[model samples]
Target: MGDRNGCSTPGGGGSALSVMAGAVIGAAGLAWWLLSEAERRRQQPRQPRSLRLSTLRTPVPAEVGTGTSSEPHERDLHDRVHELNQAIDDVRRQLESMNTQA
Candidate 1:
């Protein structure tokens, strides 16, 4: 309870003055934090962050690559495989021809 002279006795269980003081201090703290952030942003303006994109491309079978797919890496791989198979077939034919001659 306050005295007749209008002075708070500080034991009246959270007087209006304490509440006002707490509100003012909280407001000042918030204002200070906002100003610091603004100053930091002004010194180094926010840049657009670049996100890295990841590819999940894994090599499948050559036959799987050749039919309907048109990716360059897959097509190249399929062609190289086809060339190797053709070379192997030619070597087998030559060896058979030699064996027959013997």
Candidate 2:
């Protein structure tokens, strides 16, 4: 009942429809991947930034009993502290660069 391509002969009681469907889907996926590769290759490479810093924010201290167990609040505090540390490091680097240049 099956042809060489594994598709059933017409009215031969096999999975001709499924075989054709699979072929169509495979072709579409291949075409998509090729197009994506071409587009990516066409884009120019990017240069790294000389300096980067996150925006400064005045941190509000956690309230004594506002539930320190809240996950989002803890995450926010952690992120804020990290940004502050990064800013401090940037300032130190700038100072060192200035001293070296002078």
* Cα lDDT of model 2 by residue, 1-102, tens digit: 348654455654446668888999999999999999888776523212222221134355565675654667789999999999999999999999999999
Error of 2 at 102 (Å): 63
**Each prediction's whole-model lDDT (CA):** 0.74, 0.73
| Ten residues in sequence with the least summed lDDT for candidate 2 | 46-55
C-alpha displacement of 90 in model 2, angstroms?
Answer: 27
Candidate 1: residue 17 Cα off by (Å): 99
Where model 2 places Cα greater than 4 Å from the true spot, the runs are 1-14, 46-79, 83-102
Stretches off by above 4 angstroms in model 1 are 1-70
**lDDT of model 2, residue 83:** 100
lDDT of 1 by residue, 1-102 (tens): 457645655554466768889999999999999999999887663432221111224554354544655576778999999999999999999999999999
Steric clash pairs (candidate 1): none
